[model samples]
Target: MAKFPIDFLWGGATSASQYEGGHNEGGRGLSHMDFIRRIEKSDKDKVFPINVTKKMFDDHKTHENEYNFPFRRGSDFYHRYKEDIALLAEMGFKTFRLSISWSRLFPTGLEKTPCEEGVQFYHNVFQECRKYDIEPLVTMIHYDIPVYLTESMNGWEDPKMIELFVHYTKFLIDEYKDEVKYWITFNEINMIMNSSYLGGGMFVECSDKPAETCIHQALHHQLIASALTVKYFHENSKDGLVGNMIARLQNYPYTCSSKDVLATQQQNQFNYFPTDIQVKGYYPASILNYYRKNNIDIDWYPNYEEILKEGTVDFASISYYHTAVISSEPDKQEPIGAFIRNLENPYNEITSWGWGIDPTGLRITLNDMTDRYGVPIFIVENGLAAHDQITKDLKIHDEYRIEYIKAHLRAIKEAIGDGCDVMGYTSWGCIDLVSCGDAQMTKRYGYVYVDADDKGNGTYKRYPKDSFYWYRNVIKDNGADI
Candidate 1:
């Protein structure tokens, strides 16, 4: 039997806003996500309604814009974290990847004093994870920012927010330097690729300005913030590997033709350019040229050069999901990438959330990050989001999810065989909780299922899914004999 290293980490991933239900508890205040709750004025707004058709994002359409559609009460993980952590431990998780809600820590963006109650919540959470010998890998900022920061302070558009983020991060390090050993500076730093607003809370507050300038400024601020974080951690001896977590949604060419290959290259470059600049400490020629072509002038801060030189990430973490297909035309040149679209999956297996299932994309992403960055990588987030049903026997026979994870694991093994220095695998959504992108509870990705409904009603009962036993055995066997 082939064997994985004994030290290889096996775990699950989650975020504070998705699971933590006590939105108003402790000293936590309403987050940028809280505003998502206000979109329920129409019946179409009752459920999470994100459609990628031509009309949804069109301003002329009378339909509700998917971006502004309200996200509902996510599975209240804030209140049920202990029970959830116990389930993760029972599943033999070695590390738990989760985020601390920044707004929860500083309700009004920047404050004179730390929120003791909010700080203590994480202390208890980490202590619980420690009880099971599970190392906690924390991400400093997930998608949610304090709406106060977004509306009042311009959401990372101001470099002062970079200073505020540094203060918050330093406070967290000082607070948890002993308990936590792995940190991701941002949840998905490159999430700015799709929609900067949705990915990192960067562009939403800048609706009044030219979007091109606003996006450029937001990217500049995020880069500076990430670099400062790395510098602080390195100088302070924070006792952890601080890296940037990126969304590695792979892109494939539509065909073997030269145009298709160019399209694929363009897409990859566009997706990875931001992190390449931050992690590599220099701008990619491709990105600089792209910005120049768009007439986007980034008033590159003077201190940023030193910050970049001093604060490269210790490593890189990537999350893999379904890949997209791109085709190139002579006249169709995208400023950022090729014209992108999803390919129809011949394999009829779709995730519960309608995402195509393609396990091979995971291996492609791991190898790409390793080859490009030349750093050890963490599989920070990957899983199947499914509409699960609990039987009368109180069991969720989710063999489909088990197969999805196993196929991806096998693909990851292939990447390892090809000599990628992969460090760990933390499947996203360790407990049945809210979907961060759309804010629905039905799409679950946990080895342990929680009894919660879309309307936020349930006993919050924890039931071990069929994948639970499979994952436990996989860990117990040390990635062999699966």
Candidate 2:
């Protein structure tokens, strides 16, 4: 096995809504994620409506007390940061990736000044990271927008949101510039096309206009917002860098057919579109023609393209959990949500979530990215979510997860040995937090297990899973053991 670089980062990735509790505490206003409760509002894009709408968001807020919003009480990390950080430090983490909650800072996204309590809360978190010699990689925004902005400002649809986002993130840059260096503009910038609501806080399905029209318009604003945030990060912070991120949903052809290959190419092109814009600092011709073919005309400033060109990101990060198989034959496909009707990859293992486990795909994706962009790449999110079993001895023998991550790491090592400039890997949901997609806790994806359940019931205590110790040795050996 190839050894990792001495400066290679070994850490974990987490988002505020999925990891930090205290959703309503410290003067925090509700975000779109806070009101995400189960509703059977299925669309062609999904088997069930995993994404919420403005109405569903509002309704859930009205009936907030009637349900257990797992996101609101995410591992109670807002209170358990010290303990969790200690655990991660014990695991020999060199870096820690987390998001600063947008609503937590601005409350309603209209505040002239950030809630000092919210600001201080992050200060404390980053201070803890510093104590452990852990570099903090802060994501400016996750798949969350303040409920107030989404409701009143119509979220990213209104051009005003770009300014607001710029303002909000500018404050974050100024406040945390000294503590944080690597900042990600958005969690998944391209997600608006697939998950309009969670990606941009736009109720695209329920909008008065065409769904594509609304989505494209909102995405236009988000792109500009992202670009502007990158420009500001460069200007405000001396040693800081802003990077682009997306869910790297790599697809393989189901068969050796031209139709299947073409379909896969199109899907991969769309998947790479946003990052391409962020990295190259302009929209590609293919995506422009795609929008035209789809009859999607996004409204944007004439100069927005120049803004994107001026504010290209420093690096790029991706969250790759699994791969999908795309087939042109309809009968061969099965719906896996997000408007994707995919086929099974016989060569890959399957997760409980029905996602294809393709370790080799990660290496291929890494090499492709290196060749295409020629910039440093980081695997900010990758992990297996499995049903865990806690033994009578109270030890979680998550050998499956260990194997899953080990295989993925070996693939990463192969990519590195193949001369791909891969920077680091941060296992997603490093400490068990609420799962975002399913809004449940049972989809365990952490080295350390959280003693919590779907309804937010449990001791809320932390226990090291079997992967924790295994990963500690892997890090201690710096990829030599893997």
By TM-score, the best candidate is 2
Per-candidate alpha-carbon RMSD to the true structure: 4.5, 2.4
Per residue, candidate 1 scores C-alpha lDDT tens digits across 180-211 of 99999888776554555554455443445566
- Cα distance off (Å), candidate 2, residue 281: 0.8
lDDT of 2 at 29: 94
Clashes found in each candidate (C-alpha, N, C closer than 3 A): 7, 0
What's the residue-level lDDT of 63 in candidate 2?
89
Off by over 4 Å in 2: 38-49, 330-340
lDDT (C-alpha) at residue 390 in model 1: 94
Worst 10 residues of 1 by lDDT: 46-55
